[model samples]
Structure formats: structure tokens, C-alpha cells
Target chain A: DAGVTQSPTHLIKTRGQQVTLRCSPKSGHDTVSWYQQALGQGPQFIFQYYEEEERQRGNFPDRFSGHQFPNYSSELNVNALLLGDSALYLCASSSPFESGYTFGSGTRLTVV
Target chain B: GESVGLHLPTLSVQEGDNSIINCAYSNSASDYFIWYKQESGKGPQFIIDIRSNMDKRQGQRVTVLLNKTVKHLSLQIAATQPGDSAVYFCAENPSYAGGTSYGKLTFGQGTILTVHP
Candidate 1:
């Protein structure tokens, strides 16, 4: 009955460094997707993972990558972070049968 | 180049008043549309959704109306309250794109709604 859960609600990172954010999807869900939201803007789709393989991706650069474990959990990794990388990273999970997706509280990444 | 967009950047209304947020989408092939509300420091929450076949769908206190002719969609909140204040976004899915991108959503810039008590 647990909703999507993300780790390290907030974090601070310096430029050129890499960071990894984790997410535990809602029970009975198998699909995981990541999104990035900048200040005063809506979230932009990053990529989606289904069955441990990346199925769909947005217009993000190659520096942004993600992985889905067998248990349906996911991790988003951003390499060579820039100040512009500072934003709220949200994780959402959905099932193939459902029309709506559920989102986690999100991890706030601050690039210094 | 197809994208979703909102008509208003911000909206402020007094409590107990009805509120309407509008959005326009360029992808006519998008058959599924959804509305999401995001609070400060939180992820977007699903509010309601409508498909191309249907013109309207109603939720608890929210309603979504889809006009495929003009490629416009609307979310109406009845008796807006302070808790209703948040940034609203409209998302679309191009189902005809193929199976691999079936659930992929393209989101709008969002409309900020402020309900003053």
C-alpha cells in the first residue's frame, strides 16, 4: 500500500561531480519514469524504464541515465553536473493497465 | 515541435469561487490527456484525464473538458479553496506514435493557481 518513495529528499552537489537519486516504486507497479523540474517550470520527461531496460527517452542529453532493478526500483544518475542541473527530480510509477501514474515526493538536487 | 501550452501563466481567485485553467496542445495525434497539480517541493499529482473520444470527465471537485477541434483542454475546480493553490500542468500522450512510447507524456509549461482565503 506504500506510494512511491525517493531517497535523500534533498542534497547538495558541486560542479563536475556526479549524483545518483533512488526511488522505490509503489507496490504492484512495474514501470518507472524520471522527470526534471526547474524553478518556475513544469517537469520535463527524462526517460522510462520497463522490465529492467530503458524503453523510452526524452530530449535529454547523454549525461542523464537511469536503471531499473528487478524489484521495480529505479535510480537516476546525472554525470558532470552543472549549476543548471539544480532542480527537483521526480519519480513516477505506473502500471500498464492504469491510465494514471503516481509520483513520489521527489528529490531536490542543488548543484553548487 | 509539437508541445502542450497553457493560456495563463498565473491565476488568483478568492476562496469559494470557481476556477478554470486552460491549456492548448499542438499534437493533434495525442489522444490521451491528463491534468496534474504540483505543490511546492512536491511532484505533480494526477487530477483528472480525458481521451479523444470523450469530451468531458468529472472527478471529485475537478472536471476536465477536451476539445479536439481546437486542440484545447480545460480543468475546472469547483469552489476553489486555499488548498487548491498549486501549479497545474497538462500532459498528452501520442498513442499513435507506437507501442514503445505508449505511456510517454509530454507536459506543458504549467499554470500557477492561487486560491486566497
Candidate 2:
């Protein structure tokens, strides 16, 4: 089965511009979560989406938001992006009842 | 706030030698833990996981050990290969927390493993 897939493998945007990264969870998975990984750092949880609603969020600012579609696909939107927002955006999928999660290849966003 | 951290930022092991990466978590109530391997330009791949009740869990060429008392976790890789050279991360899920019924994961700083041939 295909694993979690994310679009726009790499992106470049300027400060104050909004950007949206997309993710399609692995087949048969319903829950989708977003993470941010800076260079030489581990991925940090941004938020999780289940049942089309944001179920949980990390300590990120209001500039970070996400949505889960009925098809189990997800989108992470970062508004008023800062240079610090330049990082690898990873998408993870899991079942609510299971502890294991599958992650996508991630989208590398570069803010100029 | 609680967090997970790694003791070593980088590890160098000879090819075919076994490798061990360690992590410590501050959340005592975390019930689930996972180990993920991430290669360059890729997302973290699930390597293994262990629950609070289980002291150890084994997978193909890998093992995860959990110490609830010290709140420590470890990942052991046998017969390490060049492909195993990557950053390893440990994540914990605090199921007992008041929010997030799905149990969100908090990841460590990651350990970079370099397999030297």
C-alpha cells in the first residue's frame, strides 16, 4: 500500500506570504497530524486532525492551522510566515485506536 | 512542560556492529513510546514502539526497551548497515493527559547515527 504522501516536495515563499501544504494519508488511515522539523532537529508536533476537526494542537501560534478533509487528506496552512518557518513540514497518519503512525516524505518550505 | 531528549547528539558505529541510541522523557504519565528513523530529506519512519506495560519489544533487527522508573527509552539496532546511518528520534504519547483524546506525540531532539564502513 502507498504510504502517506505530501505534495510540493519543496517550496519557497517570502515573508508575510501565506502557504498551504497538502497531505494524503495512507490508505485505511483516518487521522492526520502535522509536524515541523528544523535542520538537524527532530520533528515537532504542530497539530492533529480527526473527523474533519482539529483535535489537538501544539504550542504553535495562531498562524499555524490545519484541516482534514472527508477523504482523510490534510492541509497545513501557515499565515504570515517568518524565516523561522522555513523547515520540513511532515505529515503523519495513524488510527485513533493504534499507537503506530506512518509519516510522509514531507514538504520542505523555505521562507525568504 | 514535559519533553523528551536524547543523551547523545551523534553516534558513530562501524558497519556490522550493533548500535544503541538512548532517550529520556520527562513525562512520567506517558504510556506509549516510538522510535523512528529518518534519512536525509525524508520523514521519520517507524522503527519500533513499546508501551508502558512492556519493558521490551523486538522487531526485525531492532529492539526497543522502556524503563518506566527512570523514564528512559532505548533503541537497539543489530548488524548496522550504511542504510541505517540517519537521525533517530524517540517520541512519547502521554495518554493520561487531559487533552487530545488521540494522544499526541512529543519527539526528542534526535540522535544522528553514522555507520562507518
* Pairs that collide, model 2: none
Q: Which model scores highest in DockQ?
A: 2
Local accuracy of candidate 1 as per-residue lDDT tens digits, A12-102: 9999999999999989889999999898887888999989999889989999999999999999999999999999999999886666778
- The CA lDDT at A47 in model 1 is 93
> Estimated TM-score per prediction?
0.95, 0.95
Q: For candidate 1, what is the DockQ-based docking class?
A: medium
Segments in model 2 whose C-alpha atoms lie over 4 Å from true places: B96-101
- The TM-score of predicted model 1 comes to 0.95
Q: For residues B79-112, could you state the per-residue lDDT of candidate 2 as single tens digits? A: 9999999999999998722222374789999999
lDDT of 2 by residue, A1-103 (tens): 8999999999999999999999999888898989999998788889999899998889899999989899999999999999999999999998745558899
Model 2 - which docking category?
Answer: medium
